[model samples]
Structure formats: structure tokens, C-alpha cells
Target: MSNLLSTPYLDRYTVNLTKKIAQNPDNYRAYEREPVTNRVLVSLLKKIQNSPLLVGEAGVGKTAIVEDLARQLLASNDKLLANKSIIQISLANLMQTSDGESFAYKFQQILNELMANKDTMIAFIDEIHQIVGTGADNQGSALDAGNIIKPALSRDDLQIIGATTTKEFHQYIAQDGALMRRFDLVEVPELSFNQTANILKKVSSQLGGEITVSQEVQDQIMTLSQRYITDRFFPEKAIMLLDGAISQAKLNQRLAVTTEDVADIIHADYHVPKYVINQTTDERLANLSQRIKERIIGQDHPLDKLTMKIINREAGLTDSSKPASFLFLGPTGVGKTETAKQLGILLFGEETNFIRFDMSEFKFASSSFERFKDKLTTEVRHTPYAVLLLDEIEKADPEVMDLLLQVLDDGRLTDAYGRVVNFKDLIIIMTTNSGAKAIQNHHAKSDYIKNDQKRQENFEEQLEIALQGDGYRPEFLARIGAMIIFDVLTLADIEKIVALKLKTLDEKAREQGFHIIFEPSEVLQYLPSFEYGYEYVEGQKVVSSSIAKYIADVGYRPSRGVRPIDDTIDVYIGDPVAQAIIAKRAGQLEDFNAFIFRALGNPPSLTSPYGEWQTVISRTKEGNYEVI
Candidate 1:
């Protein structure tokens, strides 16, 4: 035990920098060129009590800067570090021993050794924050490692270089005034794009000799990593992308990394849709509006404005930190939700990427918004690139609306656990019925498309007032790219919706080997006659004039919306046909066409061999369906 105190502790717990550098020269090759290296050296050369504390975010090259300083000290002509050695002391290793001794004893022996060779030694401590409160039974212990080293550092008894993250520096070292004052802090920021590009090139030159990375591929790595890799800081994120691209090339038994190769790696690493990242802007813009229009009928005003915003975003004109956000204002069943779904399909290439939350669900109960907040953050974190539809935004509680401010303003949300969820890659759509009354009033007086420019301006002005009345702040509206007013569906628009819905139903029936056709007039007759100044009734629809007259006498009418068409089709068409098919009343359904519509008789019947007989579907005087 006495001999251990006499012998030096360097052989057991410290790695000699001179020997390590001699054995592996490549480790310091790129380090010398890194910008942080100069700052570290300057900190070390201070006039009094010089020990550089490298502080930065993790993976921003703090430890690497220390190593570069070590390399520089070894290669320099200056006597302070010339022929002198830098050895990294493992604080953890010093705390443990087979020999029975207090942790204070072992800590003192290591310090004594450094003191003996102080002039010729510089000690490096990585994760230097561990020195505080370690090897102590509790906080404020006199025998702790931090207390043992304080006097040595104060008198310049040992030159030490310490590395830790900015968080740890404040958490550990800043607490003790005596220990904190001894070292100068060197802040290492993340490398710039040009610097990161150079590092990637040097890395490829060093280890990726067999696989070539083109200049175009390097630029792509820099852009993609900066944009998509949110959880990590600079150069590290860029380097990871480069490494992944090289691996991808090798996996495919290829030699060179092209732009496509880098893109493929990014897609796999971040799960960004390949088409979204790789498609040319012109091509995407050319087909976007047409494709969205196929599923979203009417509302061409919103569609056109939305198309422009999307094209601008895709072309990289706006700030990338904020997501593309839109507030869809109008009445129910006016293609608001459908526009969001179609947008999801257009951008992400799938309907499953559409995330919808009925904001009304978060309005009533005390814990409902809390539960919804957690769910919303989790879903967006996992599916960062998606269409998030907040339906009935006006129905949500004010507290729930507060949660969206960060998302709408910064394009990021910090969850309860402090993890940042990125929304920059998302398309956020918030639908509301706040402006419905105003829109309905205007549409009843004039054609929705009349003098389109003035109409849109007036609509926007009126909708803005309604939204403000509903408690949305003007700043919240400003953050959104557009507040698109989905137009009220006219009879013609409803007809188009009916056809689209029937087409979808027909496809489903075809899958089951049944051929079905609808008599257009019969379906049209069932559509409620929506006209100017008409009032909407609940649970009752005027399918024919007799019913309309009767309902008018009572001063009630079904509102203007497309949802009734779907419900009417389901009742008058879908239900009766399914019943007939089950009963075998529509004989030999397969390989024979069956017609579904309002019937001529008291009970609705499905007619087979549909086109052979001239069946005209019409409304009787008694407000009933008749086939003539």
C-alpha cells in the first residue's frame, strides 16, 4: 500500500497523447482543419491559470477540438508543451481499486503524480462534469474528487483540459465558485454548411476511398440533413447522411454516390416520402391541381390558391422552419375534410398519411384536451410528414387552441416530456364552421363564382370578421398561408358529388361480381331542392315538390350540404339493393345488370335487365317515387 503511493498513477489510469498520436496519425488529420481547434488553443495559451473548458452541444465537436489541441501541443515548438506530454486521466478508473482505501486517498495519489510532473504534464478529462459530486457519499463532502482537485487547479499545480456539454457546465462546474474560476470556457458552435461539406469531403477522402461521392451528392447531403434531421445538430447530422449514402452504395454493389443515392438514404433514414424529395418542382406543380381536383369537387377558388401556396413551398421559397398551414373556413360537408385527404394523397402518396382530429372531441370534458394534446404530439412526432386535419377548429377549447400556437408559429411542438416534435414537413389544415353563416347569406344573394376576384376578397373580409368573432387572434390567422373559404355546394356541384360517390360505390360492387346502374332522374328526384333563401331542417328532407310544399308551409327546409346525398343514397339505394340481393329477389345478380332507384310501387324493388325496358323514374303528385 505504501509502494502504490510512491509509484506514479499515470501508467494505470491515463492514456498518453504523444503515444496515441504516433500510433494513429489519421485521427488528427481532419481535427487540425476544424475551426474549433484554434479557439481551444487560444483558451489554453491564456496569461494566468490557463485550462480550457470546451463547452458545446453534444456532437458539435467539443472532444474533437481537445484532441486537436493535444495534436497541436505535440507538434509545436513552444516550450510550455514542447517535449511535455498530455495524458487523459479517467476519473472513473481512479475511483475504483482492488486495494482497500478511501476514494479520497486514490484521488489524492493521482493528483500528487500530476503535481510531481506538473511542468511536463497536461491532463485531459472528458465528461469533466463527472468530477463534481462523484466519489462522495453525498453532496458537499470534503473528500469528493472535485474538492481534492480544487487546490491543485487553483495554484496551477496541474494543467488540465476539460470537455463537457453546455448543459453539464452549468449543472456541475458552475455551482462551485472556486473550481469554476480556474478554467476559461471555449464555446464550440456547430459548423457551417460550407465547413460541413468540407468535412464530408475529407471524411470520404480518408475512409470512403473505394466509394466516390460527387459534388452534387455532397450538396444534397448538406441540404437534406439540415432540413430533415431535426433531433441532431449540424456536421454530425450531415456526416451521418454521407455515411449512410456510402453504405447504401456499397449495399447495392455500386461505387459512386449520386444525388439519387443520397436521397434514397435520406428517405430510408427519416421516412420522408421519396417522391416528395425527389420529384422536380415543375412536374409536381403541373399535375398537383388536376390530381387534387379529381377527388375535391367545387371549391375551385380554394383549390387554386392552395395550389400556388403548395408550389411555392415545394420550390423552397418560404422559411423551412414553419410548416405549410391553412385555415379552411366554411360550412359542413363542403369538401373541407375531403380537400385535406386529397392533399395527403397528393403530397405523401397515401390516404393513411392523413391525420384527422375532430376538435369538438377536445371541447367538453376536463381531461379531454389534455388527452388530445398528448395524442396530437405523439402522432405528429411519428408521422412528421403528413396532413394534419383539425376539424371543427372553432369547437375546440381555448386551451387546446393555445397548444397549437407553437405548432402554427414555429412549426414545432415541445411535448410534455421536453422532446421537440417537428411539424415543418407537415401540411396543417384547420377546418371551421365559424364563417358558415356569412357564406350562406352571401351565396343565397349571388352566384358563388360571380366576379370571382371581388367575391374572394369580400369572402375573405367577411370570414376574417367571423373568425375574430369566434375568438381566433389576428396573429394566428396571419401565421397561416391562407384562410381558404370553401364555397357552398350548388345543385350542379351536388350532382358531381353524387356521381363521384356512386362511382366509388360501383367500384366496390364490381369487386363482389355484381353489376349495378342508377337511374339518374330517380337519384336527382331524391336530392332536396336547394334554392335562394331556403332554410335547412333537421331529420327531414324534401325529396319531391309535394313534400317541399308541405315542409314550406311549416317554414322549414333542409340546409345546403352534400352529406344528405350520401345519406339518401345509403337509404334509398344501398339498403334496398342489399336486401334484394340477400333475398334473391334481384334474380341472378351476377352477369346481369340491376337497377336501383325510387320504385313505381308501394315498396321499392330492384329491377334486373335494367336497360331492356324504358323505365322513367319520376315523382308522383303525392311526393312518392314512380317508374313510368
Candidate 2:
């Protein structure tokens, strides 16, 4: 090893590759990347242009190919490379001098040694882009490192192998036509999935201890890293995952590595939930519709369609590249956004996996569109398996809508920085009020309940016409998996929503050490029913009005959907209950265990309907009423 670096100038600023290979032979032997290694070797064998510039993305085995070439040279019968010694020149050490002249002198000495033994030595420079204009001065002498080496390279006096990333190669080396043309370019691409898995298997075998990785675990590492770890390329990312999982197993003093070990590493590094990483596809999506329905109150028709489309995509019955995209058409404050949230929770195991963008914020200008594109690409790149909800999408600028065409079509969008963000794992839901007035009009018809199927079909046709009038392109509509129409909430649905909200309120109260009970569990039913219009009888027909219309007439506004119900609960129930609890605490009512919420009126009967009702909250032991 010392003899290989025996030259004073070479020993001062370079590493001898042949010696490192001899010391740890297995590191260079396990997976040689034979195709790339042969490319580098064949280029090095050329007489006119013997140097090869290896350009690839990071972690794609550019440096490994060079090391493997050296290893092959040591045992080869090819006369050109058999006597060659590959030395890596360290640019950092060479540029340690004070000025350009001193640096140029040191580099010239290293070049002199290479020139004297040009037939027996080959130079390897990693991150070789740094060599271009490295030591250029304020004066116009082109005596920099790259310029000094060009003559020897062109004259075939020095055989060199240079490696750099694709970005750096274009940014720096490609600028100098004279220097760039001297070396043959060997473009190295990332390895395929099967290639990466084979490499992991070989590397795991080299572990050779009680700590073992099953073939199943290796397959998972490759698949998950390829899917979730999008910022990097394989087999490097896969190797890192394998190493981290093995380290985890060793820390726990376990003899065998499991899939959970790999999942934990992914969860920690990428923020993907452990359940998502650990579970199989079918397991994660098991009972998916039922799980969503548990949180979302109504809109079963749209939910059913959404569930089926997702299942179809997962089963490969549809285009698997793009996400399962949908346009949720309806009035605001319905279950559209809530359904998206529920899907996020049910599919990804948490609420944070739901990403939302209020498109109204991007409606003004091109600058806003750029901001939206940046944020959208970055978030999707980080969390590929999220439910992306674009609320009020009809309000966005035309440019922003244009941007989504590619995302819906290809399941990817390259950002301002030229990164292709993958949306294949996302569930894209866009909500709009473009046809809200039509839906509300249909719901208000006299026979809406009895003829719902026909009414819904008519409503959909009206909605497509309205969307087309609003300038929504036909191609965009065609790309969506479904344009699900969320219907106006019925009185029964609002009642269920109120109950769900009250359950949440009760949980909150219990968390603070007190319980809340809705007496009879139907005490809040009066909120959904109201009295307004007078009834009449005309010509043997009875004229009647519904509770839904009465509520709407009295400004309860059921047409606006569940938001009014939420506001009603917060004002009539939540605020009063909170105030009563505070007042009880102020009065030193610590012994009270529960608060009873009930209506202070006669329960409605056919003979005594239309009576006024008041909601009241009472502490159990205090027996004091807080009335509303």
C-alpha cells in the first residue's frame, strides 16, 4: 500500500484504491454492478480517449463501478489495465494552499507523476465537477486544475475516471466544451427492483451472524423504500433501510429481524405511520367504507361510490398510475370535506394524513399559483399516501386548474424545482359549489323524497351543464373517477349529526373530570324541527308543510347543510354546557359528577304540536337550571 503511494506528491494528496480493495475484498466483491463496470472498463481501454466520466444520480453506484473496475484490473489478463493502479485524487487536500499559484504547482506535480507512468496508472476523482475552474485567478491565466489536465487527457498521456452527479455534471463540467469533450460519458442509471433485492440478499448473507433478515423482509424493504422514500434512489435507499432495521434488531437484542423493524425505521424517517408501513394492502383497506361511515354522518351514496372506485384501483381494474380522483359536487358545509378526512384516517391511520388546500387562496394571480404548486408538490412528495382535499376548487384560477390536469392524468407533477412528485398513492378529492343552487332547487321539490332516484338523475344532468357553463373542460371531467354529488342533508341526517356532536362534547366534558348526559338520549330532537307556515285544507286535499322547510324558513338554513347544525349545537348546547360547568366550578360544586341536558317543554304530540321548547342544562347535585 505504501509503495503504491510512494511518490511524494501522490502520497501527499491521493488515496491508493488498489490497496483499499486488497484490505477489504468483500466490500468490492459482493455486487459489482457488472454492466456499468464493463462500460467503464471498455472506455478505459480506448487509446484515443481512454478516460470515462461516470454521470449518474447520487447512490446509483458510480463510485462502486470504479472500485470494481480496479478490483477486476488486479486479476485480469487485459494488458491495458492489468498493470494499472487507480489512485483517487483528493481535491480538498490539493486546494489547501494559500493561492492559485501554489495550488497549481501542487496539482502540476501530481500530473507529472501520472504523466511519467501514464501507462501504469489511472486517476479517479469523485465529485469531479469541482475540478472545473477550481484554482482560476483574478488575472486571465487559464492555469486552473481543469485546464492543466486537459492537455494530458487529450494527448492520451493520463487515463482518468471521473464521477459526478447528473446535476453537478451539467452545472459545472458541461460548461467547458474543451474539458468535457476529452472524456467518454458513461451514463449510469439506478438499478431495478429485482436487482436491488438481489443485492440486499447478498449483503444480508454477509452479515453472517445470529442477526438474520428473511427474504420476505428484504422484499418489503425494497418495496416500501421504493414507494415511500421518494426523495432517494435505490439500491442505496434499500440498503440504508436494511442497515437501520438490523441495527434496531441488535438494539433490542433480538436474533432475527422482522417486518416491524423495517416499518419502525420508515415511520421514524419518513413520517409514514407504522400501521401503514407494516400492514398489507388488503389489511389497511379492510372495511374501509364502514370505517369512513362511522365518522361521516350521511351521504352514503357518494361514500359507496368512493369506496368502490378505490377498491377498483387497488384491484388494478382501472388506471393504477393516477390516484383515485373524484370531484365532490354539492353545496358547502355538507359531508364532502368530512368524508375526505374520514378516508384519510381510515386509510392512513391518522388525521394528519389529510392535506387540504382552500383553492380560493390561489384564485388571484400567477404568483399564488406558483405558491400552490410548490406547496402541493412538496407535501405530496413527503406524504404520498395522503387524502388531498381541494376545497372550493371552482374558485381557483384557470392556471391552477390547468396544473391539476397533469396530476389527474399522470399521477405526477413536476414542481418549480423540476422534481416529479408522485400522486399514485393519493386519493384526490375536489369539492365545488358550481351546481349548488340546482341541487337545492331539486331538494325543495314537492315529491323529492318519493322520487329521489329520478330527481338525483335529473340533478346530475343539470350539474354537468352548469359545470360546462362555468368553463370546466371536458377532458378534466373525463379524467375524474366519479363526480359524486353530495345531497342536501335530511332532517334525520341532521339529527344524527347533532347526536354525534353531542357525543364529542360529552367526551370533552368527561376528559375534564365530569360527565354529560343528554336526558332520554333524544333531548335535542327539537332543534331539527320548527313551526312556521299555517296548514290548510282545500277541495278534499290537505295542505301541509314539512319540518325541514319550516326549519329553513325560520333561518335554521338546512340547505347550507351540516355547518348550520354544527353552529346550532355549539351555540344552543356546547356554549351553555360550558358556561354552566364554569359557574358550577365557581360555586365550589366539586362533588357534582354529572350534568343533565333536557328540553323544558311538553314533548310534541299530534294534538299539541307547534309548542315552543326551551333547552336547559342542570348540574346533578346543585339542582340549578341554566336555561337557553
Candidate 3:
């Protein structure tokens, strides 16, 4: 404290850290007492190499460690840095205010000022990596800030302390071999959960108001901050979380910080809500299968397995760093993508939380990686707590698959700006049609699909051979929890799906001021039929419209699945009904009834009380389907 008054060199720098340490001595005591700070002090006080280079990740207290050294030198009467100014230099401010003074000239003057008081003064450079190429012209001169300081650093005349991130240390400092060896490196690690909790408690005490924090809240804050707040490190992020919670508690007129208060603050800061992390697995798992089945049809096998994995994830039994990744390998038009949408709504409470990437669009070799970088990382980063669907994985370029391997294994991807986008809270579902042919062949011959136990085994074996033959690497396949194979929709399954589709069609009809009913037929010949190969046409609307056309033009086949039934209904049933409503044909058709009329020789006509009515007479000059 007495030494600061004697040193006039501190006046040149904007901040006199030594004098500031005197004002609030306790503020710097915590860092001074830390073990890493002692190590840095030992390095800076060495006989030959007196400079200490502090290196660590951002927010890991590298600069704090250096400040501790300053505080200690001021408080104690140590000869090494005692009676020294310990003026901290901001490289940015130094260069900014050089005022036409040459970079070399400005740095030399500072070095001369410090060296003149050799044993009594020390210069601290924070973000010291900025020195490497401080003032280099296009001609590439080596007369930079680092080079200027190298001679002084090597001579042991100008005592200096440096702090920088590990990334910049290697990138900038390590490039200059001579300058690198001059300082002893001190690596500071991020504080552990317990250590961070201790620091938060100490901070709360020092503040001494209504900001009382319990050990449990601090522990939870540590865990939550580490998981959700990927961009920041421990102690720093934990402290921010705790302080923010304290501020929120004060604003609410609360006395102390509660877990709920901390959670609310964190939820506000990061969109990841507390309900997501602390979900009630008991109730969710109990109704998981039933909830999923309501949306998906004929995927009981895969759906059950997926539900179990989700239960395990929600139960906190699985790895938090890696998401519960699954590969939905099956034929087209199965409930693979639909299951993802349903799961998104189930887990995240909204279907909009489902983010999808159509791998078919990423087939081009040139733009595949760009698409992956642009959409995958950006979307996941924005909505970390959502379901990501990569549809039609087989159609994607191998580069896309290669890029996905890291995300599958680690649940993280470095974005273009070098930010790590977290996927631990995400449910990733990748659907592929790579093994559709083999799966079809297996079901065509074997009756083992009826047995759930043997069915999974047979499906697995066939898919393994199919995917391996298709050149999907085994390592990539191994990371996924399961490669769920969806069976081809059977006639019974399609009938159930048709019933479901009709319920939707009925709702739409009622919305438009009409009520259409499907007249019960013994064999549901009213719906469109799917042949063996062309069974997967995607939606019920297409199915109904196409089926209505098929029944009127071609007629239903016995082996047809439920594909395109909605299309048939829309074209023959919906279009005709809408036209009748517009034409005011209320007397002729008092009600709309859809049924299969297999009048072998009779033209496609609706047997009505008014007269014979063809379903599709012809397109009128006004471009309306003339149904009468």
C-alpha cells in the first residue's frame, strides 16, 4: 500500500490496479487465496524467467488469477513485485491512443518507463495474444509488439505478466518460438461444482443483503448452467446464474434465492424450460405408448421401442451429452416421419418444435456440407430442446452422413462462428428407405413377423445386410439406439387407417356446412386399394381422392392397402359434394352418401331418387367437375 504512493509510472496507464486493490482489498482476496493464483505467483517470481503467462478457456478466471498476484504484491512486502506499480495494460487502448506514435516507439517508451524502475514496477498485459501481429504492414515486417517485447522479456529487465485463452495462446503466442519460451505458462482450469458453489456462497456473504443462497440451489444452478448454457464455462456461468436469480428475487421482493427462482431466471435467459429437465418420467412413460399410437398407425413395433428409449432418457438413466438418437429404417409412407412429429408434440408440447431436414435435397455433393452447416447447426442451436428429423437418409450424400456422425456420437456440432451447438436436449430421428427392398422380400416369404420376438431379430438381420450392402458405415450405424424397421401396411392396418382418415374427412365436411357419412360396406370397397408395390402414397387426402377415382374408373382390388384413399374421397366424394352445394341441388340430393356401387355394366352413377347421376359427367366450360 505504501509502495503505490512512491511509484509515479502508474499515472501513464488509465487504470491504477494497485491503487484500486487498496480501496476494496477483500474483493481480490478470494483470487489470491486460490491454489492456481499461488502457482501463477511462483512463476512470476522466478529468478531468471520472471514473467507469468496465464492460459485457460474463456471465463475460467485467467485474468482474475493475474489480479490476485497484483493484490498479493501490494498487501505483502515481497521484494519481487513489492513497491511496484503493477500497471495493467490494455493492448487495444494502447494501440488506439498511440496518436501517430510508432507502435515500436510507443511500446519502447512504456518498456523504458518500467525498466527505469526495474525492481519496483511490473506491466500486466491481458489478452496478450493481441501482441503477436499488433502492427504489421502488408509487406510482412517482423517488427510487431511481440517482437519488441521479446528482447526486453529475454533480458529479464522488463518484468511482465500475460493472460490469454488457450486457443489464442497456441494460435498466436506459440507461433513466435523465441517470445513463447520467455514466460512460464500457468494453466487455470474451470472451478468444479463444489468449488463454484463455495464461490457463490462467499459472494452472497460479501454482498450481505436479501441474497441468501442455499447449497442445494447452488448445486442445481451448477448442474443446470453446465448443461443448458454450453457457451459459457463453470464458476463464471454459475455465478451469473446465481447473481441473476438473486436480482430476480430482489425484484419480486423475496428475501432469499429459491430453486424455483433460479429455474425461472435460467428459463428466461435460455429458452430451455425447467419442466423439460425435471420431467415426471413415471406418468410420461406410463402413457407413452398410448399417446404415440393415437397419432401413428401400424408402427407398434418401432413405436414401443422408441417409447422405452425416451422413457430411459427422461428418467435420467442415459448419457446427457449424447441425445437419444434413433434411425427409423423402413419402407416409404410408413409412420417414421409422423412418429417424429408426434414425439415432438409429446416432448416439447408443440408440433412446431419438430425441425426436419429432407436429405433428398442434400443429395448434391457440392452443397451437401453447406446445407448441413447452414440448417442443422443453426436450427439445433436456436431450438436446442426440439426434435430434429432428417428425412430420407438414404438419398443424402455420404458427406451429409459423415457430418452427422459427430452429432450422433457427441450430440454437438461447432457452428460456422466456432460456437458449439448442443443437442443433448434434442430427440434426433433419422428415417431411411435404404433397406426397403430387403425388408419387403423378408416379409413376403416369412410368417415370423407375427411373433414380436422373432420379428425384431429377422428385421435386424435383413436390415444389417441391406444397409451394409448400401455402404452405410457400421460405426455410424452403431451410435443409434435402434434401427427400427416399420412393416408394410396390411389390409387390416389400412382399414383402421382409412377409418381414421374418414374421421378427419368427416370433420372437414362438417366445417363446410355439410355432413358426409361413409355408408358401411362389408368389405370397405369405398376406399382406394393399394397394389403390392405402389402401396405408399403418403396422406389420407390423396388416398381418398385417388380411391374415389379408382372406384369410379377402375374399381377396388382385394389386396389394395389404404394409400391414396383420401384423394379418392376428395375428388369423387368431396368435389362432387361441394359442387352440389354450390349448384343448390338440395331437392335432388338431400344427403351425401359415399359407398361402393359395383354395377358391372352400369356406368359410374349414383342411384338417387331424382334420377341416374354419374359421379363425374365431364369438365364443364367453366372448369368445374359437372356432377349431376
- RMSD vs true structure, all candidates: 8.4, 6.4, 8.4
lDDT of 3 at 86: 73
List per-prediction Cα lDDT, in the order shown: 0.72, 0.78, 0.70
Candidate 2: the clashing residue pairs are none
For candidate 3, report its TM-score: 0.78
Ranking of candidates on lDDT, top first: 2, 1, 3
lDDT by residue (tens digit), candidate 1, 432-548? 888788877777765556557887677778779778988998877787887787777764566566667776876776676554445344444443342221222354532222221
Worst 10 residues of 1 by lDDT: 548-557
Top of the candidates by lDDT: 2
**Per-residue lDDT of model 3, residues 173-263, tens digit only:** 9988888999988887877777777777777756536467777877778878877787788668977888788888888888878888878
Model 2 TM-score, 2 decimals? 0.81
Q: What is the lDDT of candidate 2?
A: 0.78
Q: Which model is ahead, 2 or 3, in terms of TM-score?
A: 2
Give TM per candidate.
0.78, 0.81, 0.78
Segments in model 1 whose C-alpha atoms lie over 4 Å from true places: 1-18, 31-35, 83-85, 89-112, 129-150, 166-180, 212-216, 250-261, 315-317, 364-370, 447-462, 473-475, 513-560, 572-590, 593-628
lDDT (tens digit, per residue) of candidate 2 on 1-628: 2334337888778998987897776678627388888888889878777799999999988888888788887888987678578999988888786545378889989998988777678899999998887877779878888998998888888888999999999998999988999989999999888888888989886762668899898988988899788767877899889999999999888988888888889888877877687677799778888877777767876788889888888777988778888999888777898898888988888888999999989988757778888999998877777899999888888888888988888888887788777888899999998988887777677774627787667767778989989978888888888998887887667666666777787899888877776634232322222222222223332222332222222224555666776566676667766776787778845456566554444334588565453455545544442322
